[model samples]
Target: MAKQLLAVAEQKARQMGLACDIAIVDAGANLVAFHRMDHARIAGIEIAKGKAWTSVAMQMPTANLAQSALPGGPTYGINTTNQGRLTVLGGGIPLVRDGMIVGGIGVSGGTSAQDIEVATAAVQAFAAAHTHHSTGASRTIR
Candidate 1:
């Protein structure tokens, strides 16, 4: 699962001319596989992993939490919660099976939009490879 997601993310990143660090984590928020493209920023290594972990732990895309978590917002200071392991970055996406998250994928070393693009592509790829039926809809908890 991680291998396919990494391949899909790497290919998508290259297509967009981005050097990304990608990470995958299970439902338990445990690390599974990780990859940092050549010339990728050193900071992306931990950032990507954190994104993946955050997605799995929160059961949603990290981007969804970004706005509300900002200072003065409803979830303000959430970034400081969980000992800073939780991030509100845009690169994290949960992998779902039967409407339940089985894992998550994260991509860093690019703009939030670019990271989302790569990570979304990886999720799409995973959905395609898996035999489980899906509605192909985005998950939102608002």
Candidate 2:
């Protein structure tokens, strides 16, 4: 599953002409697999991992936290609680199957939108691999 996720993200990154860092984490938020495309930003290595970790830890897409993490929002400063490892960015997505979170995927080294697109493709691939339904049709995916 991790390998498939990495392959899907890598393909998306290549399609967008981006060199990206991709990370996959299991349900426990442990790193399962990772890939750094040639010339990917050095800073993206940890950021990608952090994004995956944050998605699993928080049980939601990291993009959902962006606005709430802002000052005066419900989750303001929440990013500071996880030893500064939490990232309220758009690149992380939770992998869900049968209404349960199975893992997470994170991408970096592109614009937030591009990163989100790549991660989303990976999640869609995971969904397709596990079910017969159309990809990205899962309610747990957001």
- Please list the C-alpha lDDT of all candidates, in the order they appear: 0.89, 0.91
Candidate 1, residues 48-110: lDDT per residue as tens digits?
Answer: 999999999988899998888988899888889899999898999999876889999989989
Clashing residue pairs for model 1: none
Tens-digit lDDT track of model 2 for 1-142: 6887899899999999999999999999999999999999999999999999999999999999988999999999998896899999889999998999989988998988999999999998887877754454454432
Candidate 1, which ten residues in sequence have the lowest lDDT sum? 133-142
TM-score of each: 0.90, 0.91
Q: Which residue pairs collide in model 2, if any?
A: none
Give Cα distance to truth, residue 137, candidate 1, Å: 22
